[model samples]
Target: MRTHYRFGHEWQVQARPDAVRALLEDVAGYGAWWPGLRVLADASTPSRRAARLEVRAPLGYRIRFTLTESSVDRHELRALLRGDLEGWCMWRVVATRGGSRVVFAQEVEARSRLLRLASPLLHHRLAGQHAALLGAAADGMRRALADGEGAPGQRVGAP
Candidate 1:
């Protein structure tokens, strides 16, 4: 059995796109900010940056994936996700009146049979957990950017 998942999340960062991109590109430090996110490897460079990340929910299911950069744009970063999950994820950052608008979109399917089978009852919870994690990440980024790079902002979109 296979279960497909598509997620779209957007939030406001009280910083410039460059600051936000800098934080996002430094994937190795995700664990220091984003809870439960572990970066197994960081293959970032001055021109292109990406990483292999392990995502675990409180439900104890682990999804490991590598994000390989697939785009060459400055304001947008797209990645081909490969590993326990298969799909693509992207980050688009644009300047907003106050700061920057960050949009994150991901689509992937579960490779674990147990996870696929449990999706019917657990999808909502899983999405909620994902939302909370990103929300916290946004908060962390704001705090990190508080030193004149940015401030704090609110999270939009839904679970």
Candidate 2:
């Protein structure tokens, strides 16, 4: 049997689809807007990427995952999980009337028994965090599109 764990959030970004897609593809920019994500390793190139990340939620832990695949189709950018987590995290950008609708979805399997046992509780918290992170991303994208630089708000590094 296959076990499934998923969490996602949708937000309207005041930017074009291209702009939103650019920001999503730029993994290094994640630490600037995505809270609780401490970027341990940066994405080397536009094609292949990997990072050692310290995630605070779902029982504080660190995992180094390689971005096995990252590609854009029209407006959506898909990222496949490798190394630490076995799953997929996708970002969909749809053109709306005024801007772009962005959705962040992650479907991952528990890598350990502890993670599996805490799945129910962690799911709820992760859902909330995802929503918040998306909101922040939207704001950052808006600013970047307006100023020509994807400048994200200051974030303190993980201790």
Candidate 3:
């Protein structure tokens, strides 16, 4: 049986909602602020984009997922995933006093047999690794935005 996982995170970013939204909308630029992720995007219009992502998990695993980003509004991004993972992910960003409050939510089923078999035993470890990764990504985003990176008209981070 496949193991289904639901992960969510709430992060505080040092940027306004618009700035955060612009960063979030630029899906191709995520590697600059997100750790262990490399994204390749194919798009003809703003409403939808097809992307392939390669992620290096902390446990020495490489996860490859192909997804289609369906919508990106002023403060939200929604996507459907396939390949190694199957399900959906969403992000919501709201303006706060000194920055933005962001919510990242994902519900996915492990399609890899190794992961499915080991999930029950390594659940805690997996969760811990994911938490650490998300924490680091949050810190990276804070620094990137604070330094005026990832925002439109601002300099982009190195490849």
lDDT of each: 0.76, 0.63, 0.76
Q: For residues 55-139, could you state the per-residue lDDT of candidate 2 as single tens digits?
A: 5443455445655446667867777776546788888888887667888788877665555555566666645654665566567
Candidate 3 lDDT by residue in tens digits, 7-39:
999988766677777777776777788887778
Ranking by lDDT: 3, 1, 2
| Residue 46 lDDT (model 2) | 51
Q: Which residue ranges in model 2 land beyond 4 Å of their true spot? A: 1-3, 43-46, 58-64, 120-159
Shift of residue 1 alpha carbon in model 1, Å = 5.3
How many backbone overlaps does candidate 2 show?
Answer: 0
lDDT of 1 by residue, 1-159 (tens): 336788888988778777788777666777777776889988676666678889877667787887777784788878888787788888888999889898989998876666677777788787777787778767877777666644434332111
- Cα deviation of 61, candidate 3, in Å: 0.7
Separate clash counts for every candidate? 0, 0, 0
Worst 10 residues of 1 by lDDT: 150-159
Q: Estimated TM-score per prediction?
A: 0.81, 0.69, 0.84
- Winner by TM-score between candidate 2 and candidate 1: 1
Which parts of model 1 have CA positions greater than 4 angstroms off?
Answer: 43-48, 150-159
User: Which pairs in model 3 have colliding backbones?
Assistant: none
